[model samples]
Target: MTKLFIATTALATVLTGAAAAETIGVSIPAATHGWAGALNYHAERTIARLEEAHPDLDFVLATTPDSATQVSDLEDMMATRGIDALVVLPFESEPLTGPIKRIADSGTWVTVVDRGLAQEGIQNLYVAGDNASFGSTAGEYFAENLDEGAKVVVMRGIPSTVDNERVAGFEGAIEGSGIEVVAMDHGNWNRDTAFTLMQDWLSRFPEIDAVWAADDDMAVGALAAIEQAGRIDEMFVVGGAGMKEMVARIAEGDETVPVNVTYPPAMISTAIEMTVLGLTSGAPMTGDFIISSELITQENAEDFYFEDSPY
Candidate 1:
């Protein structure tokens, strides 16, 4: 009778453990750009850590180049994988909304990172960096450092809500500051295009005081053009998205690229962790998770430095 009771208890424990293990699907945009590449890196690392910590839980990672493909990917993941939860960094907002909403309606937990969905009341959680604050901080820095009336050039990223918010914030901060924006152009968040645009701007506006590229990759190209032109006096460049190389510049007090604002790619990790907590610990995480942006300068560069990071 005692042996039978022990055996029954062991079987019950096994069944409980099996029921606790949940499968999570993580879908993100492909690593076509530096920021997305960094997102992939952080997502992979978070998965590894979470899996080791909770041996029963399983994680699936998927990436696509565009929104339509990502929508398809999400559907396939749901149909074939039997995912209990989802963590997504959408490529774009509109095309992804319907498919993601469908997944949410199927009772799978959803955590949306960075780009938000067009349709509301779907995602269980939302995570993102403060993009508007990123631009506003940079603009404030430029205004304080330069004379009251400075001519500046702006290089924009892809035409998304994120880009528009940053531009609006920067312009709002500098309003009535006596700073004139000499030229503004879309760089498509590409280094080559930014370099070409900066070179053209230099030729067009000889009295430009500074360059703000909104992101580090474009800032690198702009920096290269400024170097090649041999125009270093009273010229400054600012960028965001805490790329390692740009953070290093801040640490070294590089005058030309003196400062940066952070929109770290690691926000994906935050989303994943939150989703896990929501599923396993009954944590109430069903709300927007907006991360803060900070200015990176020589005094505070070490805090943002990650030696092993790819971006």
Candidate 2:
């Protein structure tokens, strides 16, 4: 956990000239779920747009399905590609830290997106959504909607710093509010897994009043499960991320999915854009840029919906 801050003045030397040919390596997770699919879509779009604008700049985008593949892909980029900079959205924190840090040590400027490496000082710039706000926002919604002493279940995503931050934010917001969290489990941010988890919840908890699905995919799964069990009338579910389907539900006034929180996958665009700017803008992009999470309700669900989006 070393703190190696990049000074603004020092980055000017690393900056590539606008007219010169430059290469950037981008590593991201493969589209494993709804949010990640949107993330990949935005990354590819950004890469295409940037290439169109800066003909001299080449972006080498690689998507990995797991940490091992991500690590190997990054290594390949370092060895074969003459990349001046790297934009990485780590597949997993701990496993990818060493390879990512190696890129930095090789004198390539690094911009990390979404999930951060376990070790600090590995990347010069960091960008991600507000996991704390993501959690607490949904928790507040549950607190307001549910009756006092109501039984609630929580479905968590994969284990990571983001997951911990979100769960902490949620529990912090609902503490002592009489909204008892009767059960909590991992959904792994996958629809099928979340559906199975929700199915189990239905079988076990006969009188559950509400559920906080920490992600949009999980919320969709939970809704499907509740419908199958014919308990849609009993519990209201809260999910994060402004997924098109979930937003549609909110817009349609589907009581089963009462509300949602915003955690858009488009933040990858910001990280990629910033990385490109850092390379050619002759300025420092050497700090944290955290995207905030906001609540999505039926009153403004249309604002969050994108009809063409796959997620």
Candidate 3:
């Protein structure tokens, strides 16, 4: 009787262990830019946290620089590893939709983060930041801080739905505010490109009140150009994407960078958590999960500041 009881206990332990083990696959664009780098950092950190908390869960993180590469990575992950769940932040909407849809159809749980798929109906949960709100919030800040008739220059990102939404929201906010957008051009979301664009705008325009580099990476370059040209007092620059360096400036009450708009890269963690919740607890989750974009000002800078973060 004693031997039989011991055998039953061992079997139960093995069954519980098997039931607890779970696998998750994450695919994101490679860290070619500041925002992508931050996303990579947050993804790794979140995976570490989740793995520690759930010992039986295994997470696989894959990053690709382009749409084609990402598709290939996804295929390799699915074929070799047999992922139970997948969390993807695609490089482009159209190229990724069909491939991701096929993964979902294979009975694996799917979580789409950042960019959304064009075809839809595949994602179990979708998590993304409010790109429009990111721009609108910055516009509102500019409207309040600058004079009514202040002239500003705008530096944009790579042409995409995300960029379009931000530009639309920003323009909409400043429409009747008497703030004139003197120049608007694409910076390709790069520091050097933004620096060059700002230099040209400076040369063309005699008096500029402010500048907005929609992304922090470009903002850093814009600041460098302004400083190099000895035009620090000529304009105040505002950059979105709550990068660690910019957040620090806000914390220090830097007048030129008094406020920043947040488009957090940590949002991938939300997608991961939602995916896990659905798989483990049978939780119902679907549709878009839009994270809020809050303006990071001196008053609330501490809230958004992450000291150890690479971004």
Worst 10 residues of 1 by lDDT: 1-10
| Per-prediction TM-score | 0.93, 0.88, 0.91
Lowest-sum lDDT 10-residue window in model 3: 1-10
Cα lDDT tens digits, model 1, 166-285, are: 999899888888999989999988899999999898888878899999999899999888888888765999988989999998899899889999998999999999999988899698
Model 2: worst 10 consecutive residues (lDDT sum): 1-10
After the best TM-score superposition of candidate 3, give how far the Cα of residue 116 lies from its true spot, in angstroms. Answer: 0.8
Give the per-residue lDDT digits (tens) of candidate 2, residues 31-68.
87788899989888888899789766777788889999
Q: Show the colliding residue pairs in model 2.
A: none
lDDT of each candidate versus the true structure: 0.87, 0.85, 0.86
Candidate 1 or 3, higher TM-score? 1
Report the CA-based lDDT of candidate 2 relative to the real structure.
Answer: 0.85
Evaluation by lDDT, superior candidate among 1 and 2: 1
